[model samples]
Target chain A: MSARELPLLFIRHAVAEDSHVLGDEARALTPEGRAAFRHHARKLARLTPLRGIITSPLVRAVQTAELLAEAFGVSGVEVHPALLPQRGAHKRIVDLGRERGAGWALVGHNPSLERAAIRALEHELPDKLRKGAALALHPLKNGGFTLAWWATPGKPVKRPGDLR
Target chain B: MSARELPLLFIRHAVAEDSHVLGDEARALTPEGRAAFRHHARKLARLTPLRGIITSPLVRAVQTAELLAEAFGVSGVEVHPALLPQRGAHKRIVDLGRERGAGWALVGHNPSLERAAIRALEHELPDKLRKGAALALHPLKNGGFTLAWWATPGKPVKRPGDLR
Candidate 1:
């Protein structure tokens, strides 16, 4: 009913190992991280109908996107190097979502995910999202987007009643 | 032990009715909102030991802060006009926390809370917080602050194993 064209979900990868033994890119999600993702994925599917999934090439991010793809019944997930934490690929990712003409989920790293959101909405963030947390954004008629809601893993959503 | 000083928590009032017939400032938390707040207050108490509680004079905010004070076993809570949704009182509040040499919780309205976080960290936020959500910020060395964590009402806290 609203002019909001598409919805964007920016999610950070789940927990992973600390040792850079295999290099940061090679590190994967821990057992707990994987289990926790599965738990949260169910709730996410109920809240949003994910049409497409995109993620960074990093092992942990790839793994997180795959789980989401499975949960959302999307056949495949794409990997884009731009989703890496330090990359300046935020605008490109946002453009991709706008072109898709449907809701898409992007799994990436912190700072980057935080920055991407900042870029889209041009609003200030209080902090980097916790691992596995996601922010739902809707594109405004203007070039920017508005944050519709923020979900931290395992927490119920709360919105201000009269403040809006 | 590190250079990080006191952490500041910015929280919104719990659920409230949509009508402004009573005037926005006079509206109170709904029964469900009150119960939900009680549920979250317990979790907040376990996570951090708040040394001081500050709130807006608004009825909903005062109620929310009172619940937090009781849960954290803090003796009393104070009201600061700066916490109202439209004030530029963030720096003063930060100074207050630093002077006190302890972690303090600020409960207030949106836009202002969002603006304060953006000003302090100079980072863009994806969206204004929903009622009952909180962001934890740790000050940076050269002034300003870094977003440490963001917590939504129902999500279980999950941290990356190695990072934690």
Candidate 2:
């Protein structure tokens, strides 16, 4: 696919503490979460490089986006309020990704990010978008998107053979 | 996912010669095709281990299935007439996969394999199933399957970090 036709990557933030004394938004990525996503980001960069990351302002989401940005070698991370956990934020998140064009990763929470993906593909995913996992949605020329690929953390990542 | 809930992988045959004077069914994988799919099969095995491979009786499809079976370490390659490149073969291909349960890869020609995936997910894919690529369909509890992940040949296959 051409650069313009690249899929929009929806990334759910990594694991976090069960509760935050301050609030949910203030909760940050646990050490394990940060380490896990740092690994996943590199694997993801191979499949599709990123231009930049658009992320929820929440602490955990921002942390996740930072790891992704580092792996993709992109410097900027645009924090969007729409990615904050809320009802119907999926529509705006998709709109933002479309506006930003291809090669953009959206980092956010579960239900909303997953909902956006399900809405775009018009199919219910058998597995939940796990922590530190990403789903790619390829844009169709006639409008709408198709589920392209998914990358989940903790899978083996060794090359089978010399493809080149 | 459980062993039973594992996705059914749909694999399009690797590159083949333009035509075989003998017949379409007689056409086999090119040397390059065999090498390329050998590499892809190993990468795929890391994601989902295959118990067995079911393929179209067509020569190219059977060859592709052999490479996959080797990598997955499965002994049997079941040749099924249902995977033939005929109109409406998609339904039968899916039924066979469902009957066989999970961890099975279906090797076949395009259009039919692609159609089977589209029918299962109920969505049109943005891109055609490229040669030497695999699309996974995760089974749901209620009924039907969901698009899980995709693996394409010729991409870089390095882990970004020490994920373990």
Candidate 3:
């Protein structure tokens, strides 16, 4: 695939224990979430090769990133502060992806990940990225990006090879 | 699923003979295109139940819609002028879907279909809708819609059941 076809995978952390059960930042993925996302990540890896994973420092996001690292066979996950569930972290995430020249899976939270995709495509997207959902953004020659596809837990994987 | 979850599936007609081979309006799907799209439609039907198919009057589009009608087990196809590959047809298409309520699959040509989706979501989307690609727009309670998913020929099918 061409460099332009390389994608920035925006992934939302998987299901976690209720915030009331633990402090919000310290919450981690439930056992089921880990297993489900591990399977989903493997399916995703079959579709597109990931160079590495960038994730939030939060436990849930970090755990999600680690699963992706395992699935994609990347050595380690890079924790970034910008991925904190903030309002405007989308810009920094996109910049980080561009700086790395794409093919990176970004493990983060909702709203921000959704916003990053919308901003990149300049169009409205699925309002919510369910826990453990991954949205692919393919770079354009003009510095813009387009929605490549979206994969969520339990959804049948669409193979990109059919397009060839 | 709630009524709001019903989707308006925007499907681009499968590949057709080059416009030069025949008049643009009369162009038909090549044998390969027809066979490929038939398989794609069957996979899509397994994902979402389509109430019916609305198609462009153009031959390629009608053929594509017919396959959807077959896969979906919808009685017939509705050919509409608004899907004629013209500028600003997106509005009419969305109106038709709303008028009939959601759960309809729309088969048409690109640019207009792509624009219709962008207009509905109010965000940039994939710049192109490859032949036989179906984009699902799930309605929101606010009378708007969110992208559910996108399916293209040759991609492994993502099962919505997994989301449950």
Off by over 4 Å in 2: A1-164, B156-164
Candidate 1 lDDT tens digits, A22-47: 36764556657766776788778887
lDDT of 3 at B148: 80
TM-score of chain B of each: 0.83, 0.90, 0.89
Model 3, docking class? incorrect
For candidate 3, what is the lDDT?
0.73
lDDT of 2 at A137: 77
Q: How far out, in Å, is residue A67 in model 2?
A: 45
* Off by more than 4 A, model 3: A20-22, A158-164, B1-164
Model 1 DockQ vs. reference: 0.01
Q: Score the docking of each candidate (DockQ).
A: 0.01, 0.01, 0.01
- Tell the DockQ for candidate 2: 0.01
Q: Could you give candidate 2's per-residue lDDT for residues B67-162 as a string of tens digits?
A: 676577665555566777998899988888778767888888878888888888788874678998898888776568877777778864322131
The C-alpha local distance difference test score for the whole of candidate 2 amounts to 0.74
**Candidate 1 regions with alpha-carbon error over 4 angstroms:** A1-6, A158-164, B1-164
Which window of 10 residues has the lowest lDDT sum in candidate 3 chain B? B155-164
Pick out the ten consecutive residues of candidate 2 chain A with the lowest summed lDDT.
A155-164
Worst 10 residues of 3 chain A by lDDT: A155-164
